[model samples]
Target: MKHLNTFNNTILYDFMELFHSLPYTFLGMEKSKDAFESAKVVLLPVPYDGTQYPYKGAANGARAIIEASRHIETFDDELNLELEDLGIYTLDELEISLESALETIKRVQEAVEEILDNKKMPIILGGEHSISLGAVRAINAKMENVSVLQLDAHADLRNEFKGCKYAHTCVMRRINEISHYVGVGIRSMSKEEKEFIEENELDIYGTNFNSNEILEKLKDKVYITIDLDVFDPSIIPSVGNPEPQGLFWIEILELLKKIAQEKEIIGFDIVELSPNSNKISDIYAAKLICKILSFSFFSKF
Candidate 1:
């Protein structure tokens, strides 16, 4: 019995080694021929988190999500499509800038601009929410009448936080300067953000917001920024901030499906996943990215 157990363990080890030896792309898929030229979607992993806060591991979130994605099945039963055929190209992780958050954001903006120039949809995997401003900046510069759809627990409307104007907490404020934005799944914010929302009559919605109302506020072109904390801690507890009573899986998916069916998603980012002992959170984040892509590209309903 002991020898049999040893053999089983050896086979398992060999299987894992073979799997790891494959090309390290999202979903462990083979590299596409002329990936950059033929691909309709380009994924940019931005591993950066410069926020001065206790939750410091978000810098590793992008890699974690990619690793978790390898275990997911490539076929989506709901969409009835194989994602691998979509020519989704995963670019090398962006070189992070240590100078400052603003500098990092600038680097992100440049990378996203290049992706846009290629005429492919950009899906940014975030190290933190602040990285989203870079993509938003790039999209706003090229597209007109663009509206940002923010899905997060916090309003992130602060002008500045911890002396950093470009910190993750203040990302939406900076975005407001470039294009109109609607905030949804928001359950927390500062008095300043509340006052600002009221003053501007911004389309900021709580957890119970109607999807139709949120869609009406958006223009034809929409850039979505999803902070993982917008999900209930019960579903995804590994984030920089875990607020209570957040949106559940099916609820958020329904809303995303509606948005994908209606709005023209110019670009999107998923951020603020600080990986921890709970491996489920990492897998959940990866699946969320896949579902979003599937909805945007292949959803019939």
Candidate 2:
């Protein structure tokens, strides 16, 4: 329902360094029809961060990441190649009114299905952790054997919560309906979720669990879903739910690198970053997306 404001537009302009005198898109380049579709990877931004426990504004997560992306160097110093070589595509956000979360999830599911049907991997930036439900369903529409790699502070496996069956608390429970998954860096869990896991014999590795054990359990083609709360609050305090202690940025990077080395990451989503005017969190989220994209390519090479 809310679009970019003038101040936000000005910020985007400065970051992109574009010649506004001429008609151009975000990166100050012409929209490449062929190059865009032929792209191996696609970025989908869904600005619908609803159903929060602590803070609000994760709805702004997509815009914040896209804005900060302008500051990203096209040529990766670490990989020593232009990311454009992989043919990245960025789409305008699909329509959503933010009135109902369930309706938004259905819309997301449709958009995600289109991406998967095209045979291109989708990197969805979240409005909330609930957005993962649509992405998980999107993958299920086509793949025979798919597994989710959830990196979060809490186990989002509740069958229902807050009188909402499709609450953010129930995202993983919905994913469980379609396929198996591996949960990593989990430091929060409820008694109900614990019983559900024990009874179903699910693949869950808590914060106390070993990374190596979880890595080996992943399937060949995987969909990764990250709730930003997985990071220690000291490191990423701007998320909706700030858990005291969790994984470090580099530790997550290393974990992703290991997963990329071992499995094919079909899709991913980074949810629950509520940006502030301070701007550090925005750039951090952007860098995280860029790093994951780079890792995805570097591992294959």
Candidate 3:
């Protein structure tokens, strides 16, 4: 009995060591199950928060989201299918330098181009909303006409913020220069941003309207970016920037389902989650990813 106990303990030690050595992956899945070549979706994690201030923990978001994803059930009851069967490849986190935001975006753009070239749909997990700029730039290079659909609490249409044109607060402003955009769930914005929207007659579907109105304005190919702060603080309180009277879970999901049915969703990012001690935000972010992926891949609408 003593000899058997010793052998079991040795085996457990070896197993734990091997587990610790494995590369981190979304859903904690083995590489063999989700190989890059076979995958339909590729997850690019950009764990950078170079420009965020006050609440600055978004850099940890990618790691937290991936870690929490490991525990979710793979089967989707709404879709009535195992969405995991559609292979999801989680790449190593993008190594971005904090000193140069320009260089970081350039790196991200190049990486996204490579992912597209490989014919995989890219799902970016961001360090901040600014990261979407590079990914959107990459998408624009491949397709001649593309539109961006942003679901966020803030307009993000500032020309510049805090002396930096490339700050997260100005992400949509930068994107508007790249391609046309439609802003949804926006409850906050600066006076300048509001002026830009009104002057240009930009299509903004705010809390006052249902998301279905978004379908008419979007182009055939759309890149969707969701700032997690778009949700009410009650549901997800860990975001760097929180606004009151934001969209709830069901409302957002219903909108996404409609969009998936109506247009081709080329790529997307879920950003601005700053994990707390409870880790509930991380799990919510992960589930959001899974649900969106399932709907995008399998839904008729």
- TM-score of every candidate: 0.91, 0.87, 0.91
Cα lDDT tens digits, model 1, 1-301, are 9999999999999988887664678787667668667878888998998783777888888889888998889899988988888877888899988878988999999999999999989999989999999999899777898889999999998998878999999999999888899999999998889999999998899999889998898998889999999999999999998999999999999998899899888789999989988999999988988888898888432
The whole-model lDDT of each prediction reads 0.88, 0.79, 0.87
After superposition, the stretches of candidate 1 with alpha carbons farther than 4 Å from their true spots are: 1-20, 299-301
**CA lDDT for candidate 3:** 0.87
> Per model, how many backbone clashes are there?
0, 1, 0
lDDT of 2 by residue, 1-301 (tens): 1455877877887876753442222222235788666688777888886676656798888878777777667677987767767776778876765677788888888988998888888989878888888888888887866789999998899888777767688899988887889998888888999999899998887666666887778888889998888887777777887777798888888888778777778889989989887677767777777777777788564
Model 1 lowest lDDT segment of ten: 28-37
Per-residue lDDT tens digits for candidate 3, residues 149-268, read: 999999998888788888899999898888999999998988888999999898887777756567888899889999999999889998999899988899888888888877888889
- Itemize residue pairs with steric clashes in candidate 2: 49-127
Model 2, 14: alpha-carbon shift in Å?
A: 18
